[model samples]
Target: MAAVSVKASKGWQKPPTRLYEDNYGFGINFYQPMIDYLDAKEEKRAPKEYPHLPWSNERGLERYSSKKLVKAYSEKDLRRLVEARTKADHGAFTLTKPKTHLSLTETTSAVSAINRKGSTKEEVRVKKMSDDVFDDNMEQLASALRSAKAYAIGKSAKAIESHLLAESLRNLSSNTEVDIRSFQRRAEVSSHDSREHEWFMEQRKMKEEELEQLTQPLDQLKVELLGKQTSIEIEQLNSRVVEAETRLKTEVTRIKKKLHIQITELEMSLDVANKNNIELQKTIKKQSLTLTELQAHYDEVQRQLQVTLDQYGIAQRRLQSLTAEVEEIRGNYEQALRIKKSVEIQLEESVSRINELTVINVNLSSSKSKIEQELSVLASDYDEVTRELRVSDERFQRVQVELKHTVEVLHEEQERIVKIDAIKKSLEIEVKNLSVRLEEVEANAIVGGKRIISKLESRVSREVVSKTKISIPYSLKVSEEKYRHPPRWRNWSTC
Candidate 1:
């Protein structure tokens, strides 16, 4: 074993300096402290037996003790190990290299402990860890503490002052002296209530001035109305004066002329009355002849009235006879109408029967036409066969005899077909049961057709899918680089 020593001249001041001896082995404990202690052993010294845990054996402890193998990771332990490693380099042979991607998690049987938080229970747990593990955990804790200290130191003075100020304010508010008068003054000033009140007073003054001005216009209008009323009263007085003056002037003029004109007009009226008397005398003589003519015309009108009454009596008698004849004719007409209706109904029925017969005839004609067509075809065949038969008349005669015998047999078969049809009808009535089943049968025919179409479509889809399995991807990839192999089960093994 080669040895390393951590000297004390440096700052490390924990325990006494000890030798590090290499017993770096793997798959067993790699502690080095036991190894170094064992190396310090002399021949006179009896061997000291220690704990025999898995990591405390001679080989395990040696490897654990060696600075190269033992993973001591605290700042103190690591600094010691580094020095020991440097010293070890001076005296050592080969040493195992550190793993490149070694994780704290991957190192078992090596220091992998981390510091628990500072709680009573956590301290107890941390205290129970192995020395190497405890060292690593302490080193990590000390590093974290340093980082926390550095972070605390990095804060600005202003930030500290702000925090302190906020805390002081919170404390101050706990026992504050509030003066509502100050707050109310600030509220009233910010609200601008006094300025608003002054503005309101100014607006009210302006409105009062405007109201006074408006009332002045109303007074002006009232004065104008008074003037108009006074002018109207004066005009009424003037009209009354003019009426009185005109009335007096007309009265004087009438008094002077009224007597003189009245006398002259009376004389003229007598002359006119004499002239009217002469004219009326001539008119009366002329009207007397016209009145006599009118009397004669009145007698002629009365005679005509009498003649009309006699004619009316004759017409009334004739009308009575005509009415009697018309009543008889009405009775006959009613009978004729009924007969006409009966004839019309019969005609309609006959026409319907004719149409039915015509349709039947058309159907029969079509059947006959079909029979004629068959006969024509048979005749053509017969003509051809007749020629062939003429060529072999004896064979044809034998076939004719056979056909006659076959016709007789067909006659018997037709009778049997009739019997079978009766039996089938009887069986259908029992087996089909309900009359409603006929509708179901018809519906089934329609469903059967639809099902047939669906089945064909399914078959076509299966065919399309089958063909697409090979062709679809090829068609899609037509513009791409050609595949080295087409789709095959060999390449699709994973799929």
Candidate 2:
């Protein structure tokens, strides 16, 4: 049985070190106690100096044994030993030999029998000495028996513990294996999903780029249309301005020509009137002279003198009408000169107005150019803004898609987590059932006294259980953390 335990312990030692080193990469010191326990178990005999155990004295058991000062084992000591043995079975260190108690008891009993057989001559001294030695020996024997009983009890208890621990470890190992397989499956599915998501994102990006390429020419066309319309409007305005200028020039020239013709006509009529007045004056002068000569011959003929006086009066009336006509001609000439001067002033005013109109036209043209420039700038700005809006809209859509993807991923992870939780519950139920079975095994092991063989097996089982305790929850926590947060692409939604 001891050889089996040693072999089992040796076999168990390598796995934990390898498992921990490969999977967790923990330092070997973490399992140093187990290594030391295995080492102690493999030895054929106890070491002269045993390693410190909780039940042993700090100075060591060998010191007490060598000095013959070993005290009788007390109930408390036995209890402590039992507890320590229980701890040892659960991966703590313990050392014992099945022969020590028996050998010591036999030697003491044989020495007492030899002393009791001494002759009567030395009876008193021998009896006193033997009595003292015998009392000490008896005490030692009693202590050894009690220790043996305690060892047997502790051995039974340890066996039960080992059996229970082994059962629990077996269940835990099976459950952990299942969990690991499920986790690996989940990892594979998540990887496939991630790859699909990446491919979809690339496709979306490509489509967005294509849309931008197609829209470029359309935006350019819109800009060109706007420019053409503005140019057309500018040309129409320029044409209207040119037509108005020409009309004003034609009207000014026509008015100046009409004024010039009217002044010349008036001047010609004045000249003809002046010439008629000169001729009439000459005729009147000649008539006056004829009258004077007729007066001289009046004395010769009284009837002829009366005839001459009538003719003189008629000629004087004619002269008076001629003077009035000459004066009217002078007044009309003055009015014609006044009209000419007014027309000259009006022509000068029209010329100044034309110049102002030309300046206004130039200014209007400049303003039209400025307006065209502004319209071009506005069109460009509109195109830019539209392009930016389109890009933003595409980004928003992409973010929406990403958000949906993330949400779906989270949902799937949550479903998987729920499944994992269900598995965990089932494992817990199985563990409970195993614990019940272990308790039954413990009862049977105790009744049957088959505890000694289970020492190393218990240690190995407890170690396995401990490793599972550390590793499984950590993996679950990592998976949970990975799925808890959303993806990085969701940041674009804020934009």
Candidate 3:
């Protein structure tokens, strides 16, 4: 069995048919040499014991177990039995074919038909069914057949084993008979010599035993190859299952992680939305308060605007009345200005007249001073004539005549002096009248005349008063005394 397993492992590298062909060629070459060697050594002394077969228990079973052999044989037999049974039932089981392609409606109808029929009559009814009915009943029939096959396989393990052993024995006997007949024919041809005949017979027996030994190992090799093939298939299936499981686990973990991330994102978005909603509500409240305040402020502004408009109208009317009053005052001021101009003109004429009167007074004062000097000389001459009259009587009469003429001249001079004095007094009265009129004019033209009056007074005092201070001679005073006392010469003239 170990050699067979080794051969199987080597043979797996090549195709089965190619390995079998190679083995057949090697067996032919190997046995030919052995056969020739055996014939040449047949005449020598036989060895004490023949060599053991290469497939003996001590060699083949060193690394193999009997339980594994039994299990493999059982499984192989079970599969063979199931195949045989299915082949036998093929004609009766019409629904087994074309089961995979059946429609829903067809399956339903077939299911109904099967449920209505008895188990004993099922085969006959199924045989009578048409192709459509076969398709319709395909799935259920296939499932039922699978269950039946499973049960039969479970119960028939020993029977399958016995059947396999019987078949192997029968094949071995048939091969032995064919080989023995060929060997007998060779023995018969060489029987002319009795010793050769016996030698051929012994050789035939050895070959037979060798053939028997070879047959058993070949059977074991076939079983081992079958087991190895089946094990390879099972290993492939197991690896596929493992790969699918790993792939499914990775896919499930990925999906779970993705779902967790999405959930976290949704929660964060919800929090942000809540914050935005709260902020919006706060803004709405603030806007409402501002709107109310603005409305109140607008109303207050409207009231103030109305009050300002009314005040503006009142101020405009007051301004119109004030303008009319200003126009009346302007007319009165113009009339007062005209009156002041006339008063100023009259005052200027009065000042010019007063200047003329002052010049006349100055001339009169100068003429009076000259007349006083002349009168003083005439009084001195009169005094001298009176003294000479006392000194000589004869010259007295001539002096009296001369004195009478002088007295007449003096009388004329006195009349002239009296006229000059009267003119000076009239001039003084005119100046007083002018000053009074100027005062009256100043009082009436009160706007610009007080300064004018003060200026006129200062000018009048400087020009008129300084010129009126005239000096009179003392001789005039003596002449006035003699005239008042009436001198003795005048008394003598009267006597």
Model 2 Cα shift for residue 53 (angstroms) = 99
| Per-residue lDDT of model 1, residues 1-495, tens digit only | 546766676666676565644333432253344555565574334357643445344543543443444344776667567546444433321111121323222222123244334476433422332233434433443443344335434354344334333533432342112212222333344355677556545644664475455545434543454345434534543465456557766986896588668768877887898888788878887888888898899999999999999999999999999999999999977766665565445446544644553454355345434432332323222333223323333432443354355345435534554243344344334323422342343344345434544554565566565654635453444313113223321221211
RMSD of 1: 60.4
**Candidates ranked, most accurate by TM-score first:** 3, 1, 2
Error of 3 at 11 (Å): 99
Residues 342-383 of candidate 2 have per-residue lDDT tens digits of 544543554464455345435534543443233222332333
Q: Model 2 TM-score? A: 0.15
Best by TM-score: 3
Where model 3 places Cα greater than 4 Å from the true spot, the runs are: 1-285, 375-495
**Count of clashes in candidate 1:** 9
Instruction: Give stretches of model 2 more than 4 Å off.
Output: 1-312, 376-495
Better of 2 and 3 by lDDT: 3
lDDT tens digits, residue span 174-203, model 3: 533543554555566658999867866776
- Lowest summed lDDT over 10 consecutive residues: which window, candidate 2? 18-27
